[model samples]
Target: MTIAFISDIHGNFEALKAVLAEIDRMRVAEIVCVGDVVGYYSQVNECCDELRRRGIPSVLGNHDWYLGYGGFCTRSRSVNECLVYQRKVITSENVNWLRAFHLQMQMDTVRIVHAGWSDPIDEYLTNPSEDYFARLSGTHFVSGHTHVQSIHRFGGKTYCNPGSVGQPRDGDPRAAFATFDGETFALHRVAYDMQKVFDRMEAAGFHDYYYGGLKTGAKNLRRLAD
Candidate 1:
């Protein structure tokens, strides 16, 4: 069975729609989300509702935790600003759905989490070493927190990050996702109408400071001087 893995879909419906459309074309058998269904953008409800409608299972992400459980993102005020806006517009039912997400999930040989196993909803699993993968309990592991798409192999174990569906930061502005065909994994990128997202953000009273990095997929969120 072929499975599609998506993560960090921080409410960019345009990106999500494009990714899902591509996944549809591939006729993928199953789709799983690593999480962050809400945060950093508008249209949180659309993203959540689409996932719920498709019955896609997701692990809990830090952003989802912040909004669902009520907490501030101490690391990035921009994240908190987006969360504040999202909270006002998201449906209570979707909030409940976000609350129901698990920190990690295991499906046969595949292990999935929104971030590192040690800190499932918050850790950034970048630059993982062989020793790191050795401690993991599965043949195939998947997580997404850094918004960078990559695949690593250590011994017989494999680790994959599907990247960000909404806020990709790997120097590629396109939407990012991945697919696994049991034996191997593949990362994929597709372009979406980012202008539409920008327009929506502006309509919602946000400035370019909120979405300037999307065009180039900068490593950090863009500031006015950037």
Candidate 2:
């Protein structure tokens, strides 16, 4: 059985659709989300509805928590703007779904979480310390928070981050995901209607920087990730 992993789908329905199609083409048996099903874009409900409809299990993300309760982290002005708009437009049912996400899930020897295991909601474990790596018990540790696709191996543990499905920060702007079949791990990316997403974001009162950054695969976010 192959398990497909997706994460950081920040409400871009177009990208989600494309990624789902790609997953379908791969004939994956199980699908799981690492979270951030909302924030920084339009179609928050649409994305949430799709995931809920498909019965995909997802872990909690920081943005999902913010949407469920209130307030933003020390983020950008535009990010806060988008969150405010999302709060205004999101449905109660979708909010409930986002709020009900599990912090971490374990399947066999594989462990999945939105971010790191220590501080699941807020931490970014791109460059984990030796002590942290020593604590990692699973053969495979899957997470997504940096919006950058990566696979790291250290201390007999393999960490796989499938990147951002909605807002990829890598040099490639396609929707990023990965699949693992207990042996081989495969990473895949699919193209979506980014212009349509940009237009919708603009219609919803977002500025061009969102589109520009997404278009260029978030060169600005590289600094933050590094």
Candidate 3:
């Protein structure tokens, strides 16, 4: 079976739409999103509705927790502000759906989540250690936080981060995801009409930095190199 893993959508329908288009062309049999379905950008409802319509099994990310429960997280002020805004605008049904997301799911050999295994919902792993990877019990443990695409191997198992769909920070400046056939997994970064994304952000009154990051994928370029 070929499974597609996508995460950290953050309400950028353009990016999500672009990635899904590519996935449709691939050999994907099952698709799952490790969350953050509503944060940073403004089309929270559109993003959530699409996922709900598609029936993708998604785990809750830190931003999703904030939106679902009116709680605080370690995210930046701008991100928290975006979540605060989404809290007012998201439909009640969608909010309930977000609340129903699990922190982790296991499907045969695949272990899935939105963050690290330790804390699950809030931990961010930029370069997770092999020991940490070993602790996860699966042939493939998949997660998406830190907005970077990578895979760490320990023994015969693989730890994969599909990167961020809405807010990729790996310096490639494109929407990111991963696909797994029965044998191996590969990462993909797809380009979209980012100007349209910028226009939407502007219309929504999001800060300029949000659009700037999408334009350059310049966030933490140094950390990505390390």
Clashes of each: 0, 0, 0
Per-residue alpha-carbon lDDT of candidate 1 for residues 95-194, written as tens digits (9 for 90 to 100) = 9999999999986689999989899988888898889988767799999999999999999999999999998888999999999998899999999999
Q: lDDT of candidate 1?
A: 0.91
Query: Which has the better lDDT: candidate 1, or candidate 2?
Result: 1
Q: Residues 1-226, candidate 2, lDDT per residue (tens digit)?
A: 8899999999989999999998998888699999898887899999999999999989999889889878686756667767889999999999888878889998666799888888888788767566776776767888898888988777677778998998888789999999888865678889888999989988987778666677868846523321
Score each candidate by Cα lDDT: 0.91, 0.84, 0.82
* TM-score to native of every candidate shown: 0.97, 0.94, 0.93
lDDT of 3 by residue, 53-79 (tens): 988889998888888888765636566
TM-score of 3: 0.93
- Please identify model 1 stretches exceeding 4 Å from their true place: 223-226
TM-score of 1: 0.97
